[model samples]
Target: MFCRILRRPGVLLNQASARSLNRAIFTRSYPFLHGGPSIDKKTAQKITVNWLYHDGKTRPVSAYVGQTLLQVAHAHKIELEGACEGVCACSTCHTIFTDPVYDSLPYPSEDEEDMLDLAYGLEPTSRLGCQVTLTEEMDGVEVRIPQATRNFYVDGHVPQPH
Candidate 1:
């Protein structure tokens, strides 16, 4: 097995290098933010979103009408992870939509359902961010990033060992 020491403390040496490689590949492949429906700034409209971050911070952001939640998050540099690049291939972008907004959104596709099944904090209101496109109706919606999705290295919350 490949192994080495890392200058940083608290991170497992093995995981440090592996995580670095994965993050490189992951960030490089996050194409959802760039390529999407064209938006005209002058014509573009915005919606207010109350973002409940994983570390328990609530923030308000303006989002575009034609972009997915994941795209909005990435645009604002929100910490949500979309490992599958908004293709619905993974549940890394799992999020919760509060109240009437959750009911207003369309039903999840089979692919999204399957992915959400693997999510850490699955709830009735849970939906993958990649699958939920923002719309004018979603204005003032509350979107939450589950704490269950915290990354030990980044979020500073380590998971209990199984």
Candidate 2:
């Protein structure tokens, strides 16, 4: 009987209905699928910045609004060496972010990608700190500095605090 029904023309599976049903069922059945809380820029204030050093130290600080990651790091005296001064011309400021934050960011521009190709310890989540403009959604995110950068500086370059 099952084989006979499948052979009938109108009895075939309806892809459109099946897809809609699955979407509704899965979305409602799984709460995590709804994604976390929605973030609004107006309500998101006092972002807590995290700079994880190569030595396994976390130097947390407050970030100013409308500042890039590199700027925040520099302002806080973090060791991120933006050799090109946030121009995306060098990979000295390569930083790693968590998966969700990394995913939320827009794709890198051509210049940033060209520079990132030269970064050391590059991972899928690796990005140039200078190119990452801080947003409300990035609050409380950890920025992992790799062991080294392709630049001439050593693995741990300590620059003077501004």
Candidate 3:
């Protein structure tokens, strides 16, 4: 059913109701289905993210309110991995925030902290990407992705999107 729909332009699975599609794609029902929160250009809140990569490359991307860091990275095709998806089961989505923004975000949850322990290059500002949701106050945030990620549990393989 999905394949047939994909073969057509501007179509979705017939079994997928409007509400279901909105929930699954636009909202957080399945985090993997969406890279970031739905943004309405007119009234949408915008946040600027400076992503520092392992290659010493920096990319700036826009983030919408309520979207997680992992969402923005994935949306922008940055190389951070969400090995456990985005439920914080693993630290493959580890990220670090620059000083001001680092101090700006709320303290990490126990689950996030636990996962960070498994992340590579853990630092004082280290955080699980999936756990850092954007807010109005975080308009000019800067996050850095570690040079390498350890996903030994996933056999060291980072799955790519289809």
Candidate 4:
């Protein structure tokens, strides 16, 4: 099972390198004022997201405030098992917030709470990764994906043993 998951192409393309490229492009295109409080132009705030996978790999990704955690993971091509494509239906997107700062995010909706109940490895800090959006206050947030979700499931299609 682990081999099958790891076999996915381009799964481990150094996420930090990609993020740096993105940051460089962003900073060059839009340089914000270095000085304090009298802002005429919009300033971009950086939020650090640590995506922890079942294989003990922790990927740190940088995102702007107001971006969803799901969006950030997708951009970095991190192998988060989003079986429902972030639609809040499947528990495959379940994750636990390793960083306490995740508490700063707005409370999850009823649907999110319901879906989380179906997730494996439920814990006090468990949440649906897709449902968590990044806010300025949630800078430096860290989340972990449960091992159970690493495999993809296709209806009536069983994956062969590697």
How well does each candidate superpose onto the true structure, as a TM-score?
A: 0.70, 0.66, 0.69, 0.60
Clashes of 2: 0
Q: How do the residues 29-131 of candidate 3 rate in per-residue lDDT, one tens digit apiece? A: 4545554345576787888888888778888898788778877777787788887667666788889877778887889876567667768899898988888
What TM value does model 2 have? Answer: 0.66
- The weakest ten consecutive residues by lDDT in model 1 span 153-162
What would the per-residue lDDT of candidate 2 be over residues 1-162, giving only the tens digit for each residue? 434444458765454334333433343333133431343546546688888988889988987555678777877877788865565656889999889889999999766776677789889999998778777777888989899877745666665423
Candidate 2 accuracy as lDDT: 0.71
Badly placed stretches (over 4 Å) of model 3 are: 1-42, 152-162
lDDT of 1 at 69: 85
Which has the better TM-score: candidate 1, or candidate 2?
1
- Give lDDT: candidate 3, residue 123: 85
Residue 102 displacement in candidate 3 (angstroms):
1.6
RMSD of 3: 11.9
Better of 3 and 4 by TM-score: 3
Predictions in order: lDDT: 0.72, 0.71, 0.72, 0.61
lDDT of 4 by residue, 32-110 (tens): 2322113222576777888877788888888777655655676677656565555565566677875465466568876
